[model samples]
Every structure is written in structure tokens, then in C-alpha cells.
Target: MEGGGGEQALSADNVRGIVLALISSGFIGGSFIIKKKGLRRAAAASGIGAGVGGHSYLLEPLWWVGMITMIVGEIANFVAYAFAPAVLVTPLGALSIIVSAVLAHFILKERLQALGVLGCVMCITGSMVIVIHAPQEQEIASVKEIWKLATQPSFLLYVALVIVMVSVLMFHFSPLWGQSNVLIYTAICSLMGSLSVMSVKALGTSLKLTFEGTNQLVYPETWFFVLVVSTCVLTQMNYLNKALDTFNTAIVSPIYYVMFTTLTILASIIMFKDWSGQSLGSITSEICGLIVVLSGTILLHVTKDYERIPQSKSIYAPLSPSLTTRLTGELLDHVEDGRASDEEKVLRRQEMF
Candidate 1:
């Protein structure tokens, strides 16, 4: 019994899944640097930047190469989901953020602050906690079961909230706060990212079962998940591109990770009931893991602290006659009062004169 349990704990499929996820994250992280370079090249060649609604990057071969590499990473991620629970897979994406940061430091010549390194360490610690306490994936028989979960009132309410938040950010806030606030764009992308994550899991399940001869493709439920996944991913990619162009990756990467991971975990809890059968200790550990991850994200964002320091307005203020009025007045008064010394000084200075 002990040997069997041990074997179950470290199944080959889960091991394969972990390896695939690692590879996927490496590629995805590097893709950000490549794509950004492509965008810069495109913008230099043209007048408009990608951030302000330009698509010249699409014409750049480098951009296409980045897209291809990113797609390959995404494919690996999708396959990993079939073999491992999302709780195991999603947090691992933080590895991509670290990759992006390191790459940005070397390639983009961005400085990695001391706090930023600490943040990466916190991220790793949190991921370990989360992985250790993560609840097991449920046995899924059909795509229809996942559809039922999606349509449930609890999950429906969650979806409704996400839609409302995303809508407010896009339609209401994006017009006014979009340019100044990085959150506006990153929040939108993260919200859509959460939805995309859920859909990806559903679709991945269907494909996995189909590959095993169950033929899940015949179900309309599978098709619906595919469509939702496609829409959400496209929407996320569009806004994410804008955010990456406008904001520093150090800032955007962490904030995006915090929101996306938090929301995805929430969605999973609601839809899959991942915590239903878990002990209180496990649940508490999961929450702690989340906190640790958030702390790391905050620390990473601290690297942008230098940008937040207020610039002095005096730099632009021109010199004025009145600017030194008080000092000049005091000096003038002293000189005037000492003028009597001129008579006494005349006697002393007569020899010199």
C-alpha cells in the first residue's frame, strides 16, 4: 500500500506535466522581450508606436517569430493542463514573469532592483506552498459536466462579476483613466485572462478525453468552451500588448500576475470546488500561499518606486527679480547701515587712495 501510494504521488503524467510547464514558461518569458524588440523596430521604421493603436509590428518578421514562439509555449501549457491540475500549472507561470524580468535586465538593459530580486524569491516560496497544498483534480467524465459547472448559480455570479468589472474598465474607465492609470489596461487584460484560463481548462479536458478515444469533440459543450477560450484569449492579447507597450514590464508583469492568479484561483474554486473536500489546514495553507504571492507582486512593483517620486517644478521656473527680494533687501539694509563706516574707512583708506 505504501509503495502504491508513493507511486500515485509522483505519477509519470504529473512529472511530464511539470517539465512541459517549465519549458512553456521559459519560452513565454523570452517571447515578451522578442516581441517588444520587434515593436521598437517597427516604431523606429514608422512614426507611430504600438501602444497608441499601431499595428506595424504585424509587418515585422521579428514580431511574427515572437508570436510563433509564444504559440508554441501556449501549446505546451495547454497540454500540461491535461496531465496536471490547474493549481499545479497556473502558479508555475510565475516562472515566466521571473524569466521576463531577468531577460529585461540583460537584454533591455533594465536594472533589477534589490527588492525585485526579493520579490522573485517570495514568488518561488509561494509557489512551493501552493503546490504542496493544492487540492487534487476531480475525475471528469464529459465536457457536459464542465458546462453544468459553468452554468451553476455560484459560478454564474462569479462570471457576472467578472463581466461587470471588465465592462466598467473597458467602456467606462478606459476612456478617462486609460492613459494615466496602468491598472485600467492591466486589469482589463487580467480579467479576460481569468476567463480564458477557465475556458482553456475545459477545452483541454475535452481534447484530452478525445485523445483517449472518448471523442469529446462531438459535444456542443466542447465547442462552446473552444469559442469562449478563443474570444477571451484574443481580447486579453490585444490589451496586454497595449499595457506592455505603455508600462514597464517590471510593473505590469507583477500586477498582471497578481490579478490573473487571484481571479483564476477564485474561478477554479467556484467551478471545480477544488477546496470542497480539503481539510481546513490545506485551505489555510492555500490562502497563505496566495498572500505570499501577493507580497512578492507588491515587492516587484516597488522597483517602479523611483518613477513615482515627484519631479521638482522649480526646474522649469524661470529666474525672477523678486525671487531674491528678501535676501537682497536684507543685504541692502546691512550695507546701508555699514555705510557710516565709509567715513571712518576713508581715514584708514586715505593712505591707500
Candidate 2:
């Protein structure tokens, strides 16, 4: 009877994980679209010149809007993690690629060739497979257990830090016109976002602005982890934005979410030891799922033709004022021919000049 009950519990867990994964993926897809729109609106409101500096009072409203949107997205994601297994939820988040592609086609008027659509479908299928088959009831370790795992010497963290620093430096030196500014801005925004998340976690549900104790700011390990994660996320976002400038969202968004989702799964496993008691069969299924997701992403890559859309032509040709003025002078000359005095001709010449 107990064995049957355990089996039933396991099945329930699997169902919950799969559902959460789908929900999380939808949220992630919505987030990319929202972020793109928010950034565009912010840029429009503040004007182009606002990009010249790191800090802009004029951009405050836009930042707040973006921050709020991000916060909402994060909360939704947190809920997903709370209810679903991380392995399931993380892969499901890869659905952002499909979401982004569809949104880009309709909203941005971007073209999605046959290959692009294929890629999107592949990514979706692959990710779904991975999440669906992942182990349903891995052991849930406490914060302390997770922290111990994270504290282990990791060259990856240091490597990530160095890369981030170099990226920041490159951003500083790069000219403004090349869209390098977008990278820096993205990094800053990401950092701000990470801080916002940390604040929410630390402050609990109320999210009160009141600072009741100074000691709350003293968790170095927490801050370090936050910084690393924030920088990585921001860098990814910046790259994704830059890619969008070249590739349509359809091509770029899916690849990104797939990459991030894969990385996050690995990170979760390594940092939290979350898969401590999973069976070999469950692990194999999870791996196969990831492989399927990757296959889909590859299909998307093949479908993209790397062709830029042609610019739309204006319906009416614009009149040049200088050309109009010159034409008017010529007409006046024709009218005054042979009938006008020498003084009149001289005056007309001066006016034309």
C-alpha cells in the first residue's frame, strides 16, 4: 500500500513539474517582448541623446517601468520554481524562443523564413521533451546545503567575472554609434534587476522601502552570488539585443533561452546538488530531453537565411525647400526677361544669391 502511495505521489509531482515548466516558459516569452517594448518606449520618451551617459534623470520613468515589468516576471518565475522542479521549469523557460519569434513577426514586422519557423518548433519540442522527462522528485536541500555547494572552489565564477570586467571595459572604450552603448545599458539594467530580486527576497513579501537595520546590508557571500548572476544575465541580455539588431527575434530569442536554460540546469545541479537521489533512467530521460531541445534549436539555425529585409519606400517624394526657392527665382527671371530694368535685374540676382 505504501509503495503504491509513493508511486502516486511521484506521478503527481511529475504532473506539477510539467505544468509549471510550461507556465514558466510562457512567462519568459512574454518577458522578452515586454522588455523590448519597454526599452523602445523608454528610448523614445528620453530621446536619443540620453544614451550618452550612464545616468539620466530623464530616463528614470522608463527604468522604473522596465524594473516593474522585470519584477513581475521574476515573481512569476519564482513561483514556477517554488512549485515545479528546477530541471523542468528551467527547460520550459526555453519556450521564450517561440514566443519571441511570433511576437517579432507580428509586432516588429520582422520576416520569419521557413528555416526560422522550423528552428522555433524544434527548440520548443526539444525543451518540452527535456522538462517532461526530467526527474520529478529530487531531494530538496536547505539554503545552508545549497550555500555549501556554491562555496566550493569554482573557476567558472572567476572566469565569468573576468569576462564581465572585460566586457565592461570594452563597452567603455567602444564608440557610441556602434550600439555598444546598448550593451553597457543592458548590463546596468541587469545589475539593477538582480539587486531588485535580492531586495525582494531579503525584505520578504511586504517589499517595504524602510531600512530598519544597517546589518541587513552585510551579507558578502549573498551579494557576491547576486553580482555574478546579475552580470551573467545582463551580458546575455545585451548580446541578445545586439543579435536582434542583426538577426530577427525569431532566430535569436530561441537560441538564447535554450542556452540559458541549459546553463541554469547545470548551475542548479552543481550549486544546489538538487539531483542527489534521482534514478539513472530519470537522468537519461532528462539528458535526452535536452538533446531534443538542442536539435530543435539547430533546425531553427538552418532555416534562417541571414537576409536583411529591404527598407520600405516613401509613398510621396519629399520636396526640398532649397530646390523650390531656386525654381521660384528661375521663374521670376523668365517673367522679367527683356522687360526689367538693369537695376531690377541686379536686385533679382542679389536676392537669388
**Per-model TM-score on C-alpha atoms:** 0.69, 0.49
Q: What does candidate 1's lDDT look like per residue over 128-247, in tens digits?
A: 777666666677889998899889999999889989999999999988988778899879877777777788888888888898989999999898887887788667766765665455
Per-candidate Cα RMSD to the true structure, in Å, reads 18.7, 17.1
- Residues 16-95 of candidate 2 have per-residue lDDT tens digits of 54665455445545544454454445444445212222123235554355345434544555544534455565555446
What's the lDDT for candidate 1?
Answer: 0.65
Question: What lDDT score belongs to each candidate, Candidate 1 first?
Answer: 0.65, 0.42
Alpha carbon deviation, residue 274, candidate 1 (Å): 1.2
The worst-scoring run of ten residues by lDDT in candidate 1 lies at 324-333
For model 1, the stretches where C-alpha displacement exceeds 4 angstroms are 1-16, 30-68, 102-111, 241-251, 301-353
Query: Which residue pairs overlap in candidate 1's backbone?
Result: none
How far residue 209's Cα lies from its native spot in candidate 2, in Å, is 21
TM-score of structure candidate 1: 0.69
What root-mean-square deviation over C-alphas does model 2 reach? 17.1
